[model samples]
Target: MDTKFDLEKISQNIVYVKPVVTADLPTEVQDQVGDLDQIYAVHNASGEQLALVADRKLAFHLAREHKMEPVTLH
Candidate 1:
């Protein structure tokens, strides 16, 4: 008998999923960003297009700054 997989159960195994554009993105990045543009795209070493990255470094920096932490990568 064919059994259907439970979405909630399946979700627990997922580490990451495809990203999409959202209203939460910064205005500057949002202005330049496109409906189809992914803030971050996962790819193989060869650089093939894969998943979308909705988050950006600047946004992370802003968050870190708010917490008074160094956002710079060393």
Candidate 2:
């Protein structure tokens, strides 16, 4: 038996974790991350930010918890 799959569907579960500057974030977000210079952001395949975590580990962990395959972006 053979099956065909769409590339877009295959990559739907992939997400990326990238470091973001706290200062560059919105005023409300900056206020939430007080005293921290950087944070991590989890983004989906379409580049929409899903969540903002305090550290890289948490970012990846959160993605996995939601059944997403997380990759690091530098």
Best by TM-score: 2
| TM-score to true structure, per model | 0.24, 0.86
TM match of model 1 to true structure: 0.24
- The numbered model that scores best in lDDT is 2
RMSD of 2: 2.8
lDDT of 2: 0.92
For model 2, the stretches where C-alpha displacement exceeds 4 angstroms are: 1-7
Task: Report clashes for each candidate as comma-separated counts.
Answer: 1, 0
lDDT of 1 by residue, 24-69 (tens): 5567767766673456533332334333345655434443444422
lDDT of each: 0.44, 0.92
Candidate 1 yields a Cα-based lDDT of 0.44
